[model samples]
Target: MKLKDLAHSRTGDKGDIINISVIAYNEKDYPTLEKLVTVEAVKKFLGETVQGEVIRYEVPNLGAMNFVMQKALRGGVTRSLRLDKHGKSLSSILLEMPLEINN
Candidate 1:
């Protein structure tokens, strides 16, 4: 599924929270994310890169998952002075992630 679809799946408009959806193209990619991007890993990634609490959830319908991050933008605005807080770049980072799954 596309990121737009994923974002739409997240039904929240608090502005403080940002949710991203991701889907793996194959089985190999699936396992990589499971092994690499754990809850703590996601938290650390978002915490350092963003200014909020990151929460990730698995969704079977889309063969993907959702990441609901809080306070990602500094000053609670899309354009934060913080150099590291650009949510648009998250798509690139997530694309690099491979999802890990086990039989």
Candidate 2:
């Protein structure tokens, strides 16, 4: 399955940072989300796109987690040549991450 099967995403950006939120469709799925979406996992999943560290902030009350990736935007909107200047499309890209969720 894909992360998108159990959750949805939102994104924001500032300078070379990318902030992504992965929110579970149901609170019950938060554990599965936590298991599959680690900081290392995100770094590996994103590859070289993220040049700096990725931090995961748990929002259990909201059944969500926020991933703040440093140096992921390549240079921010005013600097990068990338198509998605604000890196908004990255949420969709992250939702495509492969997963192995068992019900």
Q: What lDDT score belongs to each candidate, Candidate 1 first?
A: 0.54, 0.91
> Per-residue lDDT for 15-65 in model 2, tens only?
889899999999999988998899988889889878999999999999999
Residue 30 displacement (Å), model 2: 0.5
Off by over 4 Å in 1: 1-14, 27-32, 82-86, 97-103
Whole-model alpha-carbon lDDT for candidate 2: 0.91
CA-RMSD of model 2: 1.1
The TM-score that candidate 2 achieves is 0.95
Query: Residue 15 error for model 2, in Å?
Result: 1.3
Q: List the residue pairs that clash in candidate 1.
A: 29-98, 29-99, 30-99, 30-100, 31-99, 31-100, 31-101, 32-100, 33-98, 34-100
Please name the candidate that would achieve the greatest TM-score relative to the true structure.
2
lDDT of 1 by residue, 1-103 (tens): 2223222222332454556665655544554444455666566544465566677787655556777777765654455675544455665555443333344
List of clashing residue pairs for candidate 2:
none
RMSD of each: 6.1, 1.1
